[model samples]
Target: MPLLLLVCFTLLLPPSLTAQQRPTTDGPSDPPARNWYHQLGGSVGWARNGNNDFGPAVALGIGAYYHHLRQFGGLVAGAGMGFELMNADREERLASLTALAEYQLGKRALRPLLRLSGGVALPVGSPGQSLDSRRAGALLHPSVGLLLLPPSGQWGAMVLDLGYRFTRVDFAAADNRGGSFEREVSYRRLTLGIATRF
Candidate 1:
């Protein structure tokens, strides 16, 4: 997250960028308040566990955000919370929530996007019988997507996101044979979502 913030500040603090990218009627994406917006979105994708299909993966998020200065690329940056869950056999498999820092760049509704989030994930339902303990897991997610915005009146737009979710996590536990194991695992997902601006 620090790395993403640094990139934001790098563009924010530069004197040279303060006058180059002003928005006009011809166009670009604005601001402090007029530039601020809120978004809510959900996604569907596939989840995998140990070389097998873990069934469907679902994700959701919501947040209010502000944009950088026009000179600083008028980029949108947001702070929000999101959840990802895995489901299989008509039951919940895993669930997690993570705090996020997000950024998107472009002059119009169709923009490229990137974000990062991290936190611990807990097994859902049966697997959660034991507490995660210190020997638990983490969800370090890095995502990239294309943001497709279509105007809806004046103050907002509809958000359509097509993206890839990179799921990074680890688990530690003792096997039935009295041996313990720790390994990093990943779930790759192709996700799409619809969001609204306010």
Candidate 2:
């Protein structure tokens, strides 16, 4: 019996020693916050008025965007300058500022993107002149588009956007009674750009 007890004690002591020597683990810790995607490039996009009374027109400008989540979807604000031609009756030189909200696909390295934007434009000249003018007001435009993510390892990042904007303007010449009425203008464009992660 004493021999058996000694043997049992010997076995138990090793286990105890091993237990004391082994390190304790606390599983995994929290992960860091996700990084944001940004883009800087030139775009020559088009616009189609909402009224359906007009066709697609072209606008040239440089655009830069940063993604954020808040009111509206994800907010995006940008500015562009270009020549705006209405029907055969009118055309104008203009500058625009815009803010938009977007819904992102997933948390993957490269995410699929969808966005909506609302912004205003300021007319530079009298209606269609490139010179200059003191007449300035606000024109509202809204748009929707798709953004493609670049491959993290070997994939490409592309931004393909199609959006429609609505705007209005009132000038003394546009209204016969010296009073101004709101004219509905539509805009549509396909913009391709690239994005990067920092």
Candidate 3:
């Protein structure tokens, strides 16, 4: 009888100890510390116009950016300025200013992102001497990119962005013949650029 009692106690002892020993898995773990970041980058790409009068063009840009990380994604905002040079016989340049936003995919060292930006484009220098009319207009830009973060260092992260940009310009002027006309110019831009975050 004592042996039977001893065996029963031995079996119950393990379960009781296990019930007390097991750690609760439902509690959340502490999150890592968050940091604010700043980035600067430049881009070069091709630009095309809706009007056939101007041939293909090349564009150059520079920008500054800032963001904060969240659980799933982060909020990104920045400003950029750039110029587009058309292939027209005369010098035709367009200068631009933009505000940007991005939704970052994850908090990992490598993250994928989606971005949207909008701003205005102003005609820079002088309009081509041959042009009838030229004026500044609104711009829309969208892109997908990747962010590569440093493990834990002061060098900052690197970013690569691939996306499309669009802008429209309106014009009204009289030709040398004094015949007046109004027209609109549209630009479709394809661009890729890299930036570093600090």
Candidate 4:
């Protein structure tokens, strides 16, 4: 009976000793975790004005974004500005501002994303050359893309985006005899751009 008690005491004593000897210095605690990210990227795509007889037009844009990484996915928001040269003959310059939102799937190196954007577009230069009074109008964009995260400890990643954009502009023209006419221009764009995230 004494030997049995001695064996039981030995087994319990080791666990208590191990617990007492365990390190308690709290050495650094793994640096806490970061849950937010910032990204910047540029895009180039094509635009077509349905009212005009022009072929596919081209546009360029630059944007910055902020993302909150969550358990299910990431939420993204950002703003961008872009310019487009429309039609072959009109050669009109259009400037735009965009507000963006995105939902990203997966937390892996490569993830798929859906994006929506809306804002305004204005004529850059003298619309008087083509019309009398020109006004800026609303714009909308929706997109699907892929995001490629960098390897561990890297600074940048690649983004592939495909989207469609729509914009409208209103203008009025005056004739020589003090008669005026009003018209609207609608633009539809198919856009694709590659960007980097940091």
Give per-candidate clash totals.
Answer: 1, 14, 0, 0
Score each candidate by Cα lDDT.
0.48, 0.40, 0.59, 0.59
Please provide TM-scores, in order, for all candidate models, with all chains considered together.
Answer: 0.50, 0.42, 0.58, 0.60
Tell me the spans in candidate 1 whose CA falls farther than 4 Å from its real position: 1-32, 48-73, 93-95, 124-136, 150-153, 166-186
Residue ranges of candidate 4 with Cα displaced over 4 Å:
1-40, 47-73, 126-132, 172-183
lDDT of 2 by residue, 78-147 (tens): 3333334433334544455555555644333223455555556655444333332233445443333333
Q: What would the per-residue lDDT of candidate 4 be over residues 9-107, giving only the tens digit for each residue?
A: 434554323323434343211111344444555555565323434764354333233333222237777666666664434445677777778887544
For candidate 2, what is the TM-score? 0.42
lDDT: worst 10-residue window of model 4: 24-33
In model 1, the Cα lDDT at residue 116 comes to 58
Candidate 1 vs 2: which has more TM-score: 1
Which candidate's lDDT is highest?
4
Task: List the candidate 3 regions with Cα displacement exceeding 4 Å.
Answer: 1-38, 47-73, 86-90, 126-134, 171-183
lDDT tens string, model 1, 1-198? 433553464455444333224333434333223544666666676544434356543533222222221222434554554554543442334455555555766444455556555565554334532223222356555665555444323465555544455555555545547666554556566665566556
Q: Which regions of candidate 2 deviate over 4 angstroms?
A: 1-38, 41-89, 108-110, 126-144, 153-157, 171-198
lDDT measured at residue 100 in model 3 versus the true structure, 0 to 100: 74
- Rank the candidate models, highest lDDT first: 4, 3, 1, 2
Residue 86, candidate 2: alpha-carbon lDDT? 36
